[model samples]
Target: MKYNLFISLFVISICSVLAEVYFEEKFKDDSWEKNWVYSKHPGKEFGKFVRTAGKFFNNEEEDKGIQTSEDARFYAISRKFKPFSNEGKDLVIQFTVKHEQDIDCGGGYVKVFDCSLKEEDLHGETPYLLMFGPDICGPGRKIVHAIINYNGKNNLIKKEIACKDGVYSHAYTFVIKPDNTYEILIDGEKVEGGDIEADWDLLPPKTIKDPDAKKPEDWDDRATIPDPDDKKPEDWDQPEHIPDPEATKPDDWDDEMDGEWEPPQIDNPDYKGEWSPKQIDNPNYKGEWVHPEIPNPEYKADPALYKKPEICAIGFDLWQVKSGTIFDNILITDDLEYAKEQLKNLKDKQEGEKKAKQALDDAAKEKKSDEKDDDSEEDEDAEEDDVKPVEEPEHDEL
Candidate 1:
């Protein structure tokens, strides 16, 4: 059942064609860290990308001679971006990566969406489509993601990319044409890229998970919630090797020393959705999720659902031209009064806009009238002069 649901999502996200956030490069360069995060991911040390807030990424790595050897890679996530929902000749989204380590240090890529850099808070809660970045993650252990502020609610649409081979930062970009084609550009070269579109259905967010499974009302973290049914061990903390941070207690606290672990309780009873699978769901447990033909789990899926990527931006829209419709271009009127009211409101709204236009036209007419009045005055004066003709010069020289 679980497997089926997993496949269901994968098929919908992968097989079905939907909307996309097309992108293109604005600048190309080989030296990273100048603009990109050369050593650390955008965090408190690097201030923030969204909201213009947060501490910045760690400067210690660069302050010292510490570079990502292999385990500690860094990224300078973009603070500005244009989603696929904008107008542009073509998205020239470009990025560059450099390797300083003898062993390739993970990977580098851009994430186009809205989300906190925090990774743990992304469980069952409705996120404003925090687009997880698509790099560093490789085959079997990779991430692809997209996000949106759909219906004023944040929706996350993810596609996991498998981990790749030896690590080296490589410049990668995805071009989005106005006609709706996602051409993958690698190192300024056109490589292979596919189409993955989405709207509302394929990413139908699971609203309910564990409704009743909630942090207990009288829950005290220091003391274990007594199990009247006694299905737990008495000395669960006696195990020297446990990750439970709260197990440090007085020796007399659990006099039994029976080495028993208490059964954990659910905080949200309505929660049924996977906290995201420990592994990809395929073979069996079937409801809706499915596997993608080409998975990119950490890819930046959606950013529009966050804040408008930019105001008045005609950047990239959807991959397919059909993805867009003239929402306001054509108006359908049913009720006469209602239609009239709408028209009036539009006119009133346009009233502010038309005022400047009307002023310009009025000024033009005033100038023309002023010219005509001057000509009329000049004509009248000329007529008076003609009536009283001046005497001609006499031939006195003769």
Candidate 2:
């Protein structure tokens, strides 16, 4: 018994470590250039990716990430790795994206590709297993996409997940389990979660309403009906609009020059239009009819729909109208606790960055105010100089 217990514990420990981490990237230095590959094909123009400190939170030593250097250009960069399968384990992809330029229209997302991808000619049409992150363009479209490629078709999440709108670092996480459940997290907090079968159109439904089923001939779906006993009374037939009984024309009213004056009409209080029988409980009415369900013939069980058999590369293939988006602290793991620990470190760094940014903003505002004051004083001096001094009275030769 003691030996068996020891073996079980050892196996559990190994499993735990296996779930800890599969890949991680902090982009702390230029070492990323050695592992990452960029598009080599010639195009109209492509933005350069550089490793540098964040625009707002500059802790010269620590705050380092990869950012797009140019504006109005396309960016395609990817890193290749050993192929791994997420067959029986949970898949988690977490990364931090910072739009330091307050991006107007851009895509700050990452794509996971299989080994069959051609990294040299990467573009929008390249096949990818998953595309996860924020895509912001104008006011109407600010969404965090959780798209997956299933059976040669791309499926988008049915629900709209809004992305954070600001100039700060935000962590976006996508987690998928073997049970066909998925969750989306922003800054370590879950924002969306549900069954993948319901959220995406990966397959046809298991059961559908029977098209052959029809309503019975005597079926009554109405909830209310007119009362047959109610009838309109003779006095209820009053006119809706009647001539005013007390109104009279003014004495100064003219009939030839000004048009003929007439008494103002008023509404009749007792008038009721077109009376009908009151509605009463519909005793013969039945409840709503629900069509019988039938098994869908087109639906086939795909246990590996959420599996990526050979995920060997990850890339950022996007377009940016205005650039300067920093991406950092990317992690791919199955251990939630490990991901949370990394996120805590990022949160701490962001707090420090926030304080630094606030101080810089305050100083800028003060400088602008001082400049305005100086401009106002200069305008006043100019106005005084423009005024002509009173000319001394000129006498004949005095």
Candidate 3:
């Protein structure tokens, strides 16, 4: 047992060492300018990406990230690198997004592209290999998308992953394996996962309901039937409601002034609803008719459906309504442990940032309260000034 454990550990170590990191960007310095490219296409009005401190933890000088500078504008920024494939290896894409402006409707997703991408022409129409991140629009759409491109079409995950809805930093991670399975993680905890073939429509369904098959006319699907011996009671012929015995007409009420007065209605105590026979087991019932299924003719199996042929570049291609979404700590690697380690290091910093943001928010609320009090006081003083103590009219006094 000890020898077998040692062998397994050795194999895992080797796999970890052999894992490749295609590219990574932390946006720590001016290096991001040269490493990244932004869209310059006209008529779209793309927003500028700026490197600055996050909106919440402005005091934390060390924390910096790229944020959109304008609101209600398109954003398309990408970085190019050597093209690599995740055909037989695990592909992990992890990134962080902080919407400090309390975004009402916008996208905070990133896309991985093929080598033929034109950075300047990147827009909504641009094709991509994968897109993963939070996309919120009002209350109806609060989803973290895990979309993958297959054969020229993109398939969205069948399962809905709820996104963290607030002004805090959230880490989104997507992992695709060679076995045609994928997992989605938020803040290093797996949220949703399933087989790629089952969760996405990358290919036609293997089996379909046979269209020609139908239930026979004599098939019985009822679970229960009326008891043949059950009969309505002879005394169950009472009306549902009757006139109240206690209600009386007033003596002063004129017959001509008011229409004929009637006693108020009261529920009949002995009345029961329409009587029916009791139900019993259906004698001839076999089962519910299930439509037969057969192999779909359009289904052509593709073993490489889960494999992303080339993931050469990745960048933010989104729009923001309230602007102030800081994106940072991006890491793309096949090593899941390395991604976890990076996330672990961020926990401490993110906690401190959260506390700092709360403090600022509390201070702003206090200031706003004070301002409201001062305004109320000013309004009282203005009212006093407007009242010239009702000047006594000399003529009226005489």
Candidate 4:
């Protein structure tokens, strides 16, 4: 009995680690630094004068350690990461940034890509970046404090943050799924805005600062990501239950933020929700726990798939999954074209209505002028009759 209990506990521990989302580099070296690419686009989709720690990675550094902001251009410090196909369910690029910069945009960010940032990999992959900064999300240039991107449209994950100074190692996390629906978390706070199902365009919505508005001075938000899997686990406890340290945060990094992790009860037996992959039911199960037992709600029920609902097979009304969602149509080949056509039709109809109104106005004006002329002629006739033969009378009087 003791041996069985020990085996069960060991298996459960390994399962928890597999389920969570985090950046893990199993194998890294001097070449990894070269993968961090440098980018400088001021007042653009990301912001003005934005830099990352990943960009400064010089291939010359054989030791590949102790990178600082002054070390390279925009202090771009990042390593190329690629998870095996058989890896866990989802992955996220998590990091902490100290808000240290001359301008308000100084803060850190987390960027995750579907593929590795390799020379052979090139530009085919799309990156989803979560940015956190001091820009307030209101009137002034509509600067977004937090943003996530996919294709062309920038999904403004956070807006309206109090722009302030100091080193705030903010945590920026975004979700990864085949469907592409995602959410943002900052310092454990969840950002609630916009739909991930919406098309990808890192560009801010019109609700942000008007495109024509004067731009603000640019600044970069960056951070140093120490390996969490390092020997001692610097900022975390040895166990997975360990929490992050209380660090300085952006002005709006408050209790009300959407993606922030709620405090967990250290001891609760009744709680059954699993946060890691290890908690999934055994694959050997011949029952409903397997994929076959669960009917594909997306497709028309094939008579062959008829089966009972297992513990995992139960579907929730709130969570509806379509057979297939258009994940990447940012260029808007079909649906966007249809929308534009509808818009043009509406505009043409409006123009036609305006022309009809102008014609009616012109007709009314012409009719009023004609009435005035007739009334004047009638008055002249009356005056002529009233005057009688004034001219002949004058001659007779003379």
Global lDDT of model 1: 0.33
List candidate 3 stretches off by more than 4 Å: 1-17, 40-43, 58-62, 365-398
Question: Is 3 or 4 the stronger prediction by TM-score?
Answer: 3
lDDT tens per residue, model 4, 264-327: 4343333344332223333333332211233323333122111111101000000001110000
> Cα miss at 48, model 1 (Å)?
14
lDDT of 2 by residue, 214-249 (tens): 999999988999999988897999988877989888
Model 3 residue 155 lDDT score? 88
Candidate 4 weakest lDDT stretch, 10 residues: 311-320
Which residue runs does candidate 4 get wrong by more than 4 Å? Answer: 1-12, 20-22, 25-68, 71-78, 83-89, 100-107, 114-155, 158-165, 176-181, 191-194, 198-398
All candidates' lDDT scores?
A: 0.33, 0.87, 0.87, 0.33
Q: Which candidate is the best by lDDT?
A: 2
TM-score of each: 0.28, 0.83, 0.84, 0.30
What is candidate 3's lDDT per residue for 149-202, written digit by digit as tens? 888998899888899888877788999988888889999999999899889988
Q: Write the per-residue lDDT of candidate 1 for residues 1-398, one digit (tens) a residue.
A: 99999998776555224323333222222232243332232232221221110111112122121122213322233332332333443433333332222122232333343433233222223133322223332235443223334445644344333322232223334444444344443333444444424322233333434333555444433322333344433333233233444445555556466455453343443334422223333333334322223333434444332223332111111111111000111111111122222223233323332454456568999999999999999999999888965798888775
The clash numbers for all candidates, in the given order, read 103, 0, 0, 34
- Cα deviation of 382 in candidate 4 (Å)? 99
Candidate order, lDDT descending: 2, 3, 1, 4
Tell me the lDDT of candidate 3. Answer: 0.87
